[model samples]
Target: MNFRDYLLPADSPRIAAARGVTPAEYAQRMLATEKAQNLQREWQTLLDEAFRGITTHGKPQPDLFHLQDEGFDNTCAVNAARALLATLSDEHHQRVCQPVDAQQWRAWYNPEIPFNDFGVRLEQTSVATREAFRRLLRSCTSPSGFEKINHLMDANHFLGELYDLTNIMNRWSFHFMIFGEPSETRPWGWNIYGHHVAFCCFIIGRQLVISPTFMGVEPNIIDRGNEHDAILFTEEERRGLTLMQALTPVQQQRATVYTLMEDPAMPPERFNFADQRHLAGAFQDNRIIPCEGICAAEMSPVQRQLLLDTVAAFIHILPEGPRQARMAQVLRYLDQTWWCWIGSCGDDDVFYYRIQSPVILLEFDHHSGMWLTNEAPARFHIHTIMRTPNGNDYGQALLQAFQQYTEAE
Candidate 1:
């Protein structure tokens, strides 16, 4: 169903009773006017800002993988890209292909609201075409990583069928775009984006970065399904909660916000501080947020291990070697990393937490339901994101530094 359909008019005594507001009040107060407008503008302004210094190069960047000697083997990735190119018709290519530097790469959203999707949609194409795209995705990500992503699509479809809103919420509603040529020696990437999920897989030589990645869902459990009962993201949710539970009372005082995920019964400052929705969500590719909350250096050995394990839940999405390399970098900076929490620490309470380091920014949140009837924040509706900060999203910052170093040499 269209996102707006869920915002039932708070006019009927029944509806009004649910939201605790009148019809006119429901329409006005329920919508996120400023945030939505900001997201729209972020898309409009991305090309000029996040990618400001980019030159108009139609091919992949030659030196994009200069620092890589291990951790990536793009044979499968290259063959898959070529296979996709060969399989697609000219009309499909024209519809799906985008420039390597297109701002479209930065246009990803996981909000419960409906938005337009670019590139090729799965349902609009032939079965062969859809299989080719899946092959391309599997070629790039780890087996488990790919499974998590695919299951999310299935869960979306399951919800669609349950609600009889399959038209707007089908599993095959995703879109795919290939930027630059597919070559093992150069930089090229692909993005598959749709409701509740978005991934940017950028590869340069044996190196890859999947940043600005988004994975979220409503009704995170499937009680009635036999075909695909997806209980996903619970590890991520549990690991975060474990760390919070392990923290000392003094540490809890340092991290807790004394607020709930829902902004109700709170002042504007609280919502502004933690955000009415997600803080480091999509369209925020260029945020320059500094570290906040407690640093890892202050944590005991057990807390540090818990922190490392939590980071692994996000980093393990990469292929084996890259995953190891990335974790090494994370370990190197563990002392510099920061962890913070917002809302109640109890297991039953919905909350938010962020894990930040020089190279990583991870956010896990219990969100207010948009599809389900729940009004207060619930564990069933969740939003989680992983970003490579300091301009490395899509590996732009790393490529730039590599370019400068080569010029000097």
Candidate 2:
């Protein structure tokens, strides 16, 4: 099902009525909630399977012969040590001591820190070393004879300390999100913290040469598989790129936007000219495009003609421009004429395609605008859609363009 379908209201009165109740009460009353529950169950099943393999292969215990104490055959101490070591090597120890890096450590230990703050801490260590630190700390312990256990603990917790600095940095990086007077502040802070933690954990795993059951489960965790196995891009990338390609040269010059798409099922033939219309239709039907204002004031008559001509060739043409003057002002924001594309899939039938590129697509409804209802107070909407090889949504074609453009240079 489409994402919009999920967002839209259902026709069932029982379901519609439930929406009025508190989320807790609604969940208790709805059958549709089972979908989420079922999905969770499936996720847990996969996790259990992956964990089973990790435990069976990654258990940290010694062999049966090693369990026999060499010097303390008669002492109970040897047996105790063997038991302790076995427990440590058990599945739980590896799970807790899972390799992590500075980013993942910060995230797992200090999610309150901001990105800018985290970046500062990251500056103190190389990505590789930060990962090593996470592994060391995860397994570190103070010996009984050590007089400076406290100091040792402090040293061990340095990664967490660095994460604290990240919190301060984050506050500065996204001051607007943090300090804005909105009643409900966005959880950008928490999101960054979680991302950092995951990234750190990934780094630790990499340094320790431990493999995660999932891809991108850790930071710097490169996917050694084919591009088709990646998950970074989504349908959103395609929609974004389509709009980006339609922008006039002036528009491309000013704005800096990045698009990312993740679709594993995207075959090479999907980029052919014959498939362009189908792709364009998919974007439009999905309504994944974001609406943003465009200024077309700066375009000379010839430039405007070129844009219209280029766009006209595509099956799906998104209109551009408010007036000649507005187009000129909008052209100053775009930075580069580049796009990125990727595709990947999962173990299931699920698939995705991602396209990251420059594009501008904006929408403004009347209710949100300053002016109340007016007879003709600019009630129009502006849309800029493109689907040509050069116009955007041409993933495979762009590769060819890049090669040709580079060869010519």
| Predicted model with the maximum lDDT | 1
Task: Please identify model 1 stretches exceeding 4 Å from their true place.
Answer: 1-39, 46-48, 52-66, 112-114, 263-277, 401-409
lDDT of 2 by residue, 32-131 (tens): 4565455435333443331111111233112111011112111222222223224332432322231211112222221112222222232232445334
Q: lDDT of all predictions, in order shown?
A: 0.71, 0.24
Candidate 1 CA-lDDT value: 0.71
TM-score of model number 1: 0.83
TM-score of 2: 0.19
